[model samples]
Target: MEKRVAIIGAGTSGLLACKYTLEKGFNPIVFEAEEGVGGLWRHTIEFTKLQTTISTYQFSDFSWHSFAKEESPNSQQMLHYLNSYAQHFSLFPYIKFNSKVMEVEYVGESSEEMEIWELWGGNGRPFFSKGTWHIAVQDTKNFSRESLIKLVQQQTWRPNLNRRMMALRCKSTRRHLETGVHQREVYEAEFVILCIGKYSGVPNIPLFPPGQGPEVFKGKVLHSMNYSALDNKIAAELIKDKRVTVIGSQKSAIDIATECAHANGVKYPCTMIQRSAHWFFPELNILGIDIEYFYANRFAELLVHKPGESFLLSLVATLLSPLRWGLAKVAESYLRWRLPMKKYGLVPSYSILQGISSCRIGVLAENFYDKLKEGSILIKKSQSFGFCKEGLLINGEAKPLETDIVILATGYKGDEKLQSIFKSHVFQKYIIGSKSSSVPLYRQIIHPRIPQLAIIGYAESLSNLYSSEMRCQWLAHFLDGNIELPTITEMEKDVKVWDDNMKLHAGEYYWKSCIANCGIWYNDQLCKDIGCNHRRKKGLFAELFEPYGPKDYVGLSHKR
Candidate 1:
C-alpha cells in the first residue's frame, strides 16, 4: 500500500503542511473540523484585524501585496486571503471539511521492539516507515444528536469544568462506546501533522467556586468564542442597549469592548474588567519609524541570549544587557507618550521586552483611547472577580456590578487541547508533563518521543503565519530525506536550552512557546538544519540591520 500522510486542521498551518508535503510528492489528507477554512479567523469578531503588518504575515511563497495598502487586514480579508492561497495551490481538494480527529493511537513498535533505537527518527531514517498512526475521525455533520447526548452522559462532560478536562473525558469515552448511533471512521497514516493552532479550539475558562460561577449570574454569560461565532449584525444585536462587562485584558477583550462601546455608546458604557495589564500600543510605530527596526533585526537579536550560544556570544549578550534595557525603555516611553495607558491605569508592570518575548503585546484598535476619554468605555483593574446574581463581583467590593451581558475573553488552552488529542496517556504525558513546564519539542516541530507525529503552529512568533510556513517547509524537507535530526539525547538537551531561554526572557509566561523576539534566529536554525543558506540577505549591513520578514524566507525549501 502507498504511504499516506494525515494533516489535521485546514488553517494556515494545515494548508502549509498540505502544500509543502504535496511538493515533496506525498499524498496528504487534511481534516478540518469546521465547515470551511480559516480556523480561528472564521470565528473572530468582524472588527478584528491582523496584529502584525501584512508583509510580515503573508506566506513566503505567496504575497499579500494586493492588500498591501491596508497595513492590517481585517478578519474577513484575512480569511479571503487564506482562501485565495488555498485555491491558488489547489489545497481545497485535499481538505475533508467537518471531519474532526477524535483520537490518535500509535500502533507501531512495542516497548521491547523500540529498545535498540538511539538516533532520532529511528536511526536517522524517517520515522514514518517505522510506525503507523491510527486516527479516529468523526463526521461532525453526520453525527447524531442522540449519540452526542450519550457521549456527553457517558463522559460526564460538564460546562463548568475547564475545557482540558472535558476533552480528556470525551476522548476517554470515545474508546468504550458500545452504541452504533455514532458514525466514526478510522484512518491509517504513516505520518500525522497537527496544525491546530493554539488560539481557538478549547477556551481556557477560569475556575470558580460553586456559588460564584457563571451559573449564578442572572444575565446572559458567554465566552469570547461564542460571541465571535455570531455574525456582526447578530453580535451587535446581542449587546445593543445592554450594560456590557468584558472580562480579561487581551486583544479579544479590547476588540469586544470596542464593539460594545460602538453598540451602546456612553449611555450604557462598556466596562472592561482586567486581571492584569499587558503592553498594547495604538500603532506599530515610534517617532515616525516602524517598530520592527528596533527589535526585529539580527542586530537587535544579538543583545538577547539565545539557546546553545558560545562563551564569547554569552559574554557579548551580557555586556549588551544595558543596551537592551535602553531600547525597551525607549519603546515604553513612546507608548506612554502616544497612548493613555497611564491615564487609565493600564500600564503593565512588566517591561516591553518581556511582553514581546511572551508574544503578549497587542495592537489596539483605532480611537480606543478616544472611546475611553468620551466615557463610552471604562477600565477597571481587579486582582480577582467572580460571578454574582447581578453580574460580576469584583473581589473586596461590596456589591456586584449590574450588567446584562458578560463576555469572558480568557485565552485558549492550546497545550491541553493538543495533549487531549492523543489516545495514549504516555504520549499525552510526553506532550505536556506538567502545567508549568513548556512543551518540549525539538525545533518546535517534532517531539523526540513521538517521532512519527510533527506538530506545527503551537510555538508562536511575531508573525504566526510566517513561523508556521517556515516550520512546514522544514518538515517537508525532513520528510523528503533532505534533513536529519539529532539523537534523542541531543534533541532533549536542545529543548531544555530553548526552554531555559524562554524562562529567562518570558518570566512567568514562558510556557507560551513564543519565539517572537528571536524569530530570525529560530528560522536560521531551521535553515541550517535543512542544509540551506541561513543567511538570506546579500550584504552584511542589510542582513544585520534590515528587518527580516516573510520575503526573506521565500524558496527556502527549494534551495536545499
Candidate 2:
C-alpha cells in the first residue's frame, strides 16, 4: 500500500506540501476549512498587496513573470494566482474543501510503555511506522444540521418524539450538550503535516481589568479579523459617517486606517492609537536602489551572527559589527528624508536591522503621508488604553475620545492556535514550552518530542511563500528517506543556539519564529540536509555578492 499523508490546510504551505509529497510518490489528502483555497489572501482588505516583491515571493518552480508584470500583486490577483497554480498541478482532486480537522490522536504504544532513550520518537522502531494518527474531520457544509442532530441526540430527546419536535428543541438542547461534541469522521494516516498560516485564525486581544473591557463601551467594537471578513462595500459603509479609532501600529492597522481615510475623507478623521513604534519604509527602494541589493546576499549574512557558527566566523562577525551599524544608519537616514516620521514622533528607537530581524517592519500605503497632512488621519501615541462609555480612554487623558467604532488591529496568537489542535495533552505541552520560550523545532519543521508529524508555515521570513516552499520541499525529502535527523539531544541544543541568536538580534521579540535576515543561512542548512550543494550560484564572487531569491533554489528536490 502507498503511504498516506494527511495535510491540514489548503493555503500556500499546504499546496506546496501536497505537490511535493506527490512528487515523492506518496498519497496526500488536503483538508481545508474554507470553501476555497488561498488562506489569508482570501480574507484581506481590498487594498492589501504583497509585502515582498513578486520575484522573491513566487514558488521556485513557477515564475510570477508568466502571470503578470506588476512588481507587487494585490490580494485578489494573488488568490487567482494560487488557484491557477493548484489547477496547473492538478491538485484539486486531492483537496477536500470545507473540511475541518477537529482533533488528532496517536494510535500506538504510549511513552509509558516504551523504554527511555535519548533519541526522539522511539528507540527500536522505524520512525514512520512507529505510530499512526487518527484525525477527526467535520464536513463544514452540513455543520449546522449535524450540530443540531448531535445536540438533540445528546440531551432531552425521546425515542418516540417526532423528528420535527426534536429539531425545534435544538436551540435549548445545544446549551446542555457536552463541550466539543460534533459529528465527525475518523481518518487514519501514516504521516500528518500542518500547514496553517500563523498570521490568521486566532485573534490576540489584550486582557483588560474589570469594567474596562469592550462591555463598557457604547460604540461598536470589532477585531481586525471581523473587519477583513466584511465585503468591500459593507466595509466602506461601516465607518462612512462615524468617528473611527484604530488601535495598533502594524501592517493591518495601517491598511485599515488607510481605508477609513478613504471612507470619511477629512470630515471625520480616522484616529490611530499607537502603543509602540516600528520601522516602515515608504517603498522597497532606498535612494534609487532595491533594498535586496544590500541585505539578501551571502556577504550580507556574514556581517551578522548566525546560530552554531565556528569560532573564527564569530570573530569575523564581531569585527564586521561596525559595518552593519553603518548600513542601518544609512537606511534610517533615507527613511527620515522621505517620510515625516520625526515630525509625527513615529520613529522607532531600535535600529532598522533590529526591526527587520524581528519582522516588525512594513511598507506604507501610497499617499499615506498625504492623508496625514490633510487631516484625514490622526496619530496618537499611548502606552496603554481601555474602553470607556463613549469610546477609548487613552493613557494620561482625563476624558475619552468620542467615537462610533473601535477596531483592534492586534495580531494573532499563532502558538496557542497550534497547541489547541492536538488531542493529547502531552503533545500540546511539547508544542509550546514556557511563556518566554520560542517554539522548539529542529530545522523549524519537526518537533523532537512529536513523532510522525511535521509543521510548516509557522516560522516566518521576508517572504512567507518562499520560506514555506523550502520547508515543504525539505520535509518531502525527509519523508522519502533522502535525509536523516539528528538525535533529540543534539536537536534541542541546536534549537537553543538559534534562540540565543534570535534574542541577540531581536531583543524583546525573540519569541517570534522569524528568519528575516538569516534566510539564506536557513536555506543553506536545508540544502545540506537534503544532500544537495549549498552553493546555488556559479562562482565564489557572484555567490557572495549576488542577491538570492526563489529562483536560486529551483530544482533543489530533483538534485537530491
Candidate 3:
C-alpha cells in the first residue's frame, strides 16, 4: 500500500507539508482545528495579528500580495490573501477542518508486544509545533521499549525507519457542540494537520496579579485581540479624552498607542506601562514580506529593520536579552551617529535587549515619542507593583488615571497543553527514555530510537522568515526518506553533550530549569546529523554554528 502520511497544523508548515507530501506520492491528510487556514497570518489585522515582517512570511514558491508595497499587512487583508492562496493552490480540499485529534497511538499491529515496540520507537505519534515542546519519558512501562522494538521489526513502518507519529485533528469551537459550523458537521479523518496557529484558543489577557492579579481592573479590561475595529472609533473615544495607560509596551502597545497618537492628529501622551526598556529597529523584511506589507496599509513605524542584516539577527538579540542592554546602548549610540534620521514618527521603543521584541506583545513604544507629543498617551515605564480600583500602581506609587477600557496587550504562554497529554508516569518515562535534557527527540525533529515519529516546528528562530516554511521542508526532507536521522546512541549523546555544555557555561549547579528547546540548538543538531559528507549537504556555516557564543549570535545566519 502507498504510504499514508499525516500533516498536523494547516498553518505555515502544515500547508507546506501538504504540498510536499502530495508531490512525493504520500496520501497526505491535513487537519486544522480552526475555522480556516493561514495560521497566525490569519489574523494580521490592526486589532488581532502577529507582528512578524512580511517579506519572508511564506515559502519560495509563494509570496504575499500585501508585501508588494506595504511594510506590514493588517489582519483582514492577510485572512483574504491566505484564503486566496489556498484556492489558488487547491489545498483546501485535502483539509479536514474543525476536527480535533483527541488521542493517537500506534495502531493496526496485531501483537501487543509489537504494539509496545512501535510505541517506543522514534517518530512516535503526535507531531508537535514550533515553540511547543515536551520532555521525554524516563521509564519503560509507559512506552514499553521491548514491545516497540518488536513492532518495528514486525510492522511495515515508514520507509525512513522512524516510527513516531504526528497525531492530532482539527476541532470546532466548544460552543459549537451545542450547534455546528454550517454543514461541515466536523468529520474526523485518518490523518491530521494542525495549523491551529501558534497562538492557541482565545488570546488570553493575563491578569497582572494572581488573586491580586489586576484584581482592580475596573476600567473594562480587554485584550489587544478584542480592540475596536474602526481606527477612528478607538481614536475618537481614547484621544485626549482620558489619561490612557496601555500596559506591556510590545508591538500591540506600539500599534494602539501610535494609532491613538496619530489619529489625534497631534501629540498624544499616554503612560506606557512595562517593566524594562525595549530595543527598536526598522522593518526591512520578515518571512519574505517587506515592511511595505504594513506601511502601505497606513501603519506608521512599518519599516522595522536595520540596513544590513537578515531577520534572524533580531531573534538572537531577543534570545540573548540577558546580555543585550549594555551591548545595545553601544550599538544605538553608534547607529544614531551613523544613520541618524532627520525625523521619525516613533522612537523610544519597548523592545528590550537587541531590538526584536519578546513574544510580540502590545509593544509599540517606538511610536510613543511621536504619538506622545500629542499629549494623549503617557509613557509609564515603571513596573506595576500592584493594582487598585482607581488605576495601576507603579513602584508603589498609586497613579489613578481616567480610563475607559483596559486592553491587555500581554501575549501567550509557551504551549504546555501538549505536554499534559502525556504528563502521567507512564507517558513521561516512555518518551524520556535515557535522555539527559528530558526531551529525547533527535535533531529536534524525530526520536532516534523510534524512527517513524517526527516533530517539526518546535524551534524558535531569530529570523521569523521561512522558519515555519523551511521547517516543513526540512520535515519533508526527512519524511521523503532523503535525509539522515541520528542513531539512538547519537541522540542520547547530543542530549548529554548539551547538558554538559549547559553545566560548563552556566556553572554545574545553575538552574537550567526554565530552558525550553530553541532553534539554535536544533539547527546545530541538524548539521551534526548530516552524513560525514562535509562536501555534500553539510556546508561550512551549518558546521560553524556548533560553537557559536551569545555575542556571536549576531552571526545567526545558517545554510541547509
Candidate 4:
C-alpha cells in the first residue's frame, strides 16, 4: 500500500504506466481531467485517420488486427482500441475520470525510519501528505464540452495550489465552469508518473509581425487543437462563400485543407499556405512491405549509427553514403512521378532522409492530387505572415489576401505545460535547461535530479505507443528496485552524448534528438538494460535484412 503512485493522464502512456505498475505490484491511481479515456484521439475530429498504419500504432501486448478493419484506422476506431485496451486490462476501475490535477508539489523526501506528513492549505479540503508525497487535483462536479475546453486551456498558473486558486479564477474562465463548490482533493502517494503526452494543450500560434493590433483581422481564427468543436454546420457557415486559408503544410494543415475542400466543394476554394516543402509518404507499404521495414529496422540503423565520439560508426555511414543517398533519391523521384508536387511548387530542396530525420514527414492524403487538379484545393507558398486590415500579409506582399477564416495548424507547445507544473528551481536547472526541448532524461524516463518521478512520451519514436510501452516497462522495473540508475554525473553524461549525436546529425533542435530517427540504437540500449532479447529475427539473412516490427517485441518483457 505504501507503494502508491499517481499517474497524471489516462492517455496511451498513462494507461500503459498503470498496466506496468500493476505488473510490478504497485498501486496506481490514474487521474484524467476528462470524463473518458482516449486523450487527443477522443477530442480529434471524427474524420481524422492515423498518421501511421494500425500495425505501427499498436501496443506490444495488444493487437489491432482483430478490431481495426482499415489499414489505418480512423479516430473513432482509435478511440475504440484505447477503450478496449483499458477494459481488457481491467484498468477502468483504477482510473478517476473528471479529476484534474491542479498542482503537484514535492513536499519533502522520505526515510524508511520516520513518519512524515506535509500540509498545504488553499483551495478546498486542506491537503495533507500522509505518504511520502501528495498531488492536488481539481474536483469536477460535472462533465461538459465547455468544461473540457477550459480544462484543456488551463488558466490556473501557479504550481502551488494554496497560493493561486481565486486569482486563477479571476484571470481565466475556469471559475465559470465550477459549480460554486471549490473543492480540491490531494492524493498521498510515493511516486508521481507524469504521462501527459504532447497533444492536449493550448495551440502554438506565432505572433504576427509588428503593428498587428488585437482587432487586426475580421476573420474567425482558430487552432487545430479545437478542430473537433467546429461542427459541420458551423464549418459550412464559416466557409460559406469565403476564402478559407489554412496556415501550415504539416499533417493537420493538410487534413484541414482537404476537409474544407470537401466541405465547401467548389464554393469556398480552400487554399493551403505552405511555408516550406515537406516530404509526404505517398504509400504506406513500399514494394508491398511496411515502410518501417525499409528504414526503421535494425539493419537500417546499423548503416547510419553514430556511436558518440566513435569514428567507426561515422566511417560506416561515410562509406555507405552513396547507397543512402541513392535510396532517398529514388524515393523522391518516385514521389515526383506519383504526384504533381513540382507543378504545385511543393517539391522539397533536401533529401527525403534528411527531412525524415528532421521530423517533417506526413502521410499523403487520398485523392489529394485529384482534388488539387480539380481546383477545389489550391497551394500557396509564403515564408512569413503579417496582419493587414483585410487579412494576412504574406511574405511582405503589398496586398493582403482576403480570407474569412484562418486555421492555424501549428503544433502544440509540448514541454511548456510540463515545465509550468514544476518549480523554477526544478524546471530550469534540471528538467529543461535554458529554453531547450531536451528533457535530459536518462533513457528518456527517469530524471537524475527529480527523484521518484518518471516522465514518459516526451521522446519520439517511429511509433510513440511502442516507445512508451518500453519506457513504462523500464520505469516499473526501476521503481520496484529490480534495476538501479547510475550516478547523476553518469546520467548527465549519457544525455549529453545523445544531444551531441543528434546535433551532429540533425542540427541543434531538441526534437531532432528523438529516438524515432535512431529507433534500433535506442531500443537496443533499453533491451540491454531490461534483460530482453532485442534481436527479433534468427537466421543470418533474417537478422540482417528482415524488417522488425511490433510482433517481434510482443512478450519481450517476459523474456527478462
Candidate 5:
C-alpha cells in the first residue's frame, strides 16, 4: 500500500493538499470536523457574500465565472462552487467528514523493540520512542486511552521493522453508533500536513473581569460565529423591536450591524460600539476603478519589499503625505455628502493608504448609508465596554445602554485555536514559548523542531486561495523530493528575518503570522523557490503601472 498522509481539516487548503498529495503518489486522508467541505464558507447563511472580488477569491485551476452567475458570489454560491470543484477533481472519496482530530503523537524507535505508553493530560503526548506516529477520538474530555492502546496493538501486531507511525486521535460517528465506543487509529506515514485555516476553530471573545459573565447581562449575548449560523427566522425574532448593540469595527461588526438594522424591515435599529476609529472603504470602487486594482494588484505591489517597506516608495508616500491625505479628503467629502457620517461622528482618523496597506479595507454593504440616514443604525464611538446594573456601559458615557441583544464580532483568536490541538508543553516551548509570539514556521510552512510536518494556510495574503495554492505547489514538490529545505539553523534564521521584517512593515500587534499586508512579498518568495518567474507582465509601463491579480499568477509553478 502507498504510504499514508494525515491531513487535518477539509477547507480550501486541505482540499488542495489532497490534490497535490495524489499528484505526488501519496494516499491522503482528510479529517474534517464539519459535515461539509467549504470550511467557514460552508457555515454562512444566505446574506453572506465574499468581501474580495471573485477574481481575487478563486483558485488557479477553477474559475468562479465558470460556475457562479455573479461577479462576487454569495456564500451559498461559493459552497456550491467548492462542491463542483471537488466533483471535478473527484476528491470526495478521500474526505472523512465529521471527524475531529483529538491528538497526534510519534511512536516506536529505530527497529529493535516496542515499549509501553501511558496517558496524561495538559502536556505533550508522551513519546516512548523516536518513530513517527499519530493516534484517538472526540474532544479532550471524551478520550479513552485503553481503547486507543487496544486498537494500536491490533493494528501493529507484526514484528517492528523501522516503523514510522503518526497516531491520530480522532472522533468519528460510525464507531460510536455501531460499537458504542470511540474510533481511534494510528497512521504510519512518511509525512503529515496540517491545512487548518486561521478561522473557524475558536471565537475570540473579550475577557471580562471576574464575576461578569453573560449571565449578568439581561440581553441575549452571542459571538458573531453563532449569529452567522442563525437561521433567518431566529435571527429576525432575536432583534425584533429591540435595541441591539454590536461590538467591533471590522467586517463582521459592520455586517452584523447592517443585518440587525435591516432585520424585520428596520424594526430594531442597532448601535455600533467601536473601540477605536478605523479607516473603512465605503465602496470597493474608487474613482471608477476597483480599490484592489489600485492597491493589491501588481504595480502597486512592486513598490514594497520584504518587511513591507520601501526606500523609494516609502519616501514618496511620506513626502506626498499631503497628497495622500488630500485624496482621502476627497473620498471622505463624497461619502459625507451622501451619508450622515458627520452627524453620527463616524469620521475616520487614519488615511486610506494606511488601511489598505494593513489589509483593513471594509466594503460598505448595500443600503448601509441609507440605513444610517433612516436612523436604523447608530454609531457610539467608545474606547472600551463595561457592564452596568441594567445593561452595558460605553466608555466616556455615564448612561447605560439598554440593549436587547449584544453581538460580539471581534474576530478569531488564532494562536489559542492553533495551540489547542497539540499538547500544552510542545505548543508552548516549540510553537509559542511563554512569551506570546507569531507563528515561527519557516517560509510559513514548516517548523525547525517539528519533523515531517507542514502547515498550510497559516500565512494569509491578499488572496488566500491563490496564496494557499502556491504553498501547496511548493509543498508537493518538496514532498516528492524535488524541492529541498535548508538546515535547521538556516531555517530558524529565515523565520527570524520574516518576523522582524513583518514587525517593521505591519507594525506591532498586527496579525504578524499572516501575510495579509505582504501578499506580493510572500508569493514572490514562494515563486522563486518553485523556479517560477515572479513577474507576470513585461515592459516598463506594465512593470510600473499595470495592476496584477490572480489571472497573472495562475499555474505559475509549472512555468519553469
Candidate 6:
C-alpha cells in the first residue's frame, strides 16, 4: 500500500485515478500543472456550455448533481461541479497543485515483484488535502458488455491526455529530479497510474494560407476557445450592421455561424461556407427518426436491441455520418411527419454534445443553420480560404462583404505539446496496443518494459469514459498482480492488429490517437480477456448509462 502512484493532471481522469487508487489501497500522488484541478474542462475548452451526447456518458452512480443554470451547464457550471466532486470526495489532500512532474524514468530492472517509479515535482504549492476524491464503485450484476459499460460511465468528464504526454519534455523544467527517462529523486513504487489527459492538446486545425489567415482578418479571427465577451459584444454590434461568415466544418465553425445568424437577424447577411452538407438536429439527436416522438417510444426500441455484434456490429446498423447526412437531406425535402413541427432538428451548434456524462463538453451544440434558414435566421454559404482587407475571400473569387467583427471559431491543437514523441523513431516503430502504450507501454495502459508503471487516459478511439475508467480498473488489477500482462510477443501481436484496424476504419492520423473514451479502438478485447472484472461485471452502475433513459435519445437522437 505504500507503493507511490503518480498522476500528472488534476483534471477529471486525474481525480478519478485518485479515487480508484485509494479504494484499491495504493498511494496515489497526483501532480497537476494547473494551479487548480479540472484540466482543460477547467482551463481552456472553447465553448462554456459544452454538453455530451454519449448515452452512457456519465458515471454509473453519480446523479446529475449540478443544476447547470441554463438547459445545460456552462463552463463555470462544469467547473463548479468538478470542484464540488473534488471537495465532497475529499480529493484535495492527495494533489500537488502548481507542481509539474517534469519527467519519468524506467530505471533498472527490479528483482522484487514490484516496479519502481522515480517520482519528483516542484517544491511549489502545498497539497490542499491528502486524498483527492477517493470513492469506491461496486457493480455486481448484469450480463451484457453494455451493462458493464453503464457501471463505468458514472465518472463523466475525462480529458484526452495522449498528446500532452510530450509535456514530459516539451515543457521541461529543472528543480527536483530530471533526466531523459531516468529522472532523479527516483521514488520506486509497485504501481504507477498515469492520469495525464489527452484531448485539449489534440486539435486538428486544418491549416490554410498562413499569413493571409487570421492575421489577415481586419477585425478578429481568434480560436474558438479564446473567443469570449469582447468577441460576443462586437458580434452583437456587427449583427446590427454588417455581413458575417463562419468557416470550418467542425463543431466550432458551426457554433459561431449559428450564433451570428441568430444574433444578426435581418441586418447582417450571414454566410456559412460548408464544404459539404450536414444533417441538423436538436440539442439531442436522433439519426433517422422524426424529432418529436423519436425520443419517446420509437427510439427506445432501437437502444434496447441488444449488442449488434462485439459492440462493433452496431457500426453496420448505425451507418456512418457520410451515409447518414445524405439520407437526412432526402427526408427533410420529402418526408412530412404528422407531429407538430417547431423548427425540428435545429438546435444550437453548441448542442452537438455526444460525450459521456463523466467528461461532458463545456458548451451546447444545437442546430442553428435550419433556424436561420427559416427567415428569423440569416445564413448562406461561401467557403473562403482567408480574408482580404476589404472583407473575407471566398474560394478564389474575391468576394468582399464588409463592416465590423469576425469570430474565427477556429479550434485548438492538443497534440502540439507532444510534437517530440511523434518525431521519435521509437514512437513510430512500436506505436500499437492503443492502450496508452506509446512509451514502451502496451495498449496505452501499461509499459511492458516497465511492468508496474501504468497510465489511464490514452485509448484514443470511439468510447472515452468507458475506456478511461476501464484502464484505471485494469491498472489497479495489473499493479495488484491480480491479472497478467500480454507476453511481449502477444503484446506485439495485439499492437499489429490495432495498428491495422485503426488504419482500416479510422485513418493514418489515428496512429497517434486522442479518443480516450472507447477502449475498443485498440485492445478492448484484451482487457476483456484478462478479466478486468469491472468491464465484465453487470454491476449497478450500468443502469444509469442507458441512452434511452434520457428523453429524445431514442433513435430520436444519437442516444447510443
Q: List clash counts for every candidate, in order.
A: 0, 0, 133, 0, 15, 98
lDDT-better candidate, 3 vs 4: 4
lDDT of 2 by residue, 1-560 (tens): 23668899999999999899888877678878766778888789977888888878898877787676888788988998899889888787777776677778887858674335466567411244557788777656555645633532211111211112222111111111123755676777777899887776678898876788999999899888778877788888888878999999999999999889988889999999998788888878789888887888888899989998889878988999899999989999999998999888889888898898888888887778888999999999988888889988888988988899999998888998899889888888988977777788889998877778899998888889998998988998888887777887788888888877888899876669888878999998999988888899999999999988988887685454
RMSD of each: 5.6, 6.7, 13.3, 7.3, 8.5, 13.1
Alpha carbon lDDT of residue 475, candidate 5?
Answer: 81
Q: Pick by TM-score: which candidate is best? A: 1
Q: Distance from true position, residue 496, model 2, in Å?
A: 1.0
State which candidate has the highest lDDT. Answer: 1
User: Candidate 5: which stretches are off by over 4 Å?
Assistant: 108-130, 139-188, 307-342, 433-436, 538-540, 557-560
lDDT of each: 0.82, 0.81, 0.43, 0.69, 0.65, 0.44
Show model 2 residue runs off by greater than 4 Å.
Answer: 113-115, 123-127, 144-182, 558-560
Using all chains and alpha carbons, the TM-scores for the candidates as numbered come to 0.92, 0.92, 0.60, 0.86, 0.81, 0.60
| Ten residues in sequence with the least summed lDDT for candidate 5 | 115-124
**lDDT per residue, candidate 4, 1-560, as tens digits?**
34567888988999999998888776578877766777777666545688887777898778998787878788778888999999899887777776778766665543321212121111111112242455777866343446545665532121222211222211111222233445666666667899887766757888776797326788777777666555556655766677788888887887778777877776778888877878887667664667777677656776675545358777877888777777777778778887888999989876677666666677877667777888888888888886666777878567778888788887877667677666435434566664443777788887656655789888876677877887888777667665646666677788878766665555533363476567767777777777787777888788777766666666446345
TM-score of the candidate numbered 3?
0.60
| Better candidate by TM-score, 4 or 5 | 4
TM-score between model 2 and native: 0.92
The TM-score between candidate 5 and the true structure equals 0.81
lDDT (tens digit, per residue) of candidate 3 on 1-560:
22446565666667766776665556566655444666655433343343544544444555665434554456666667667666776677766554333333333322333334422242333332111211111111122335433421211111112112223222211222221212122222223333333344335455455544565667655555445322445445644444455676556666666655555443334556766444444434323343323222211111222212246854553455444344335545543443332243233443222132222212133445544455665665565545567665567554555455555666543233333333244443545454334344444445444324455454334333344444454555555555654445655666565444333322422222111123333333343333222222245653332322222221122244
Candidate 1 residue-wise lDDT, 220-264, digit = tens: 987787788777888888899999999999999999999889878
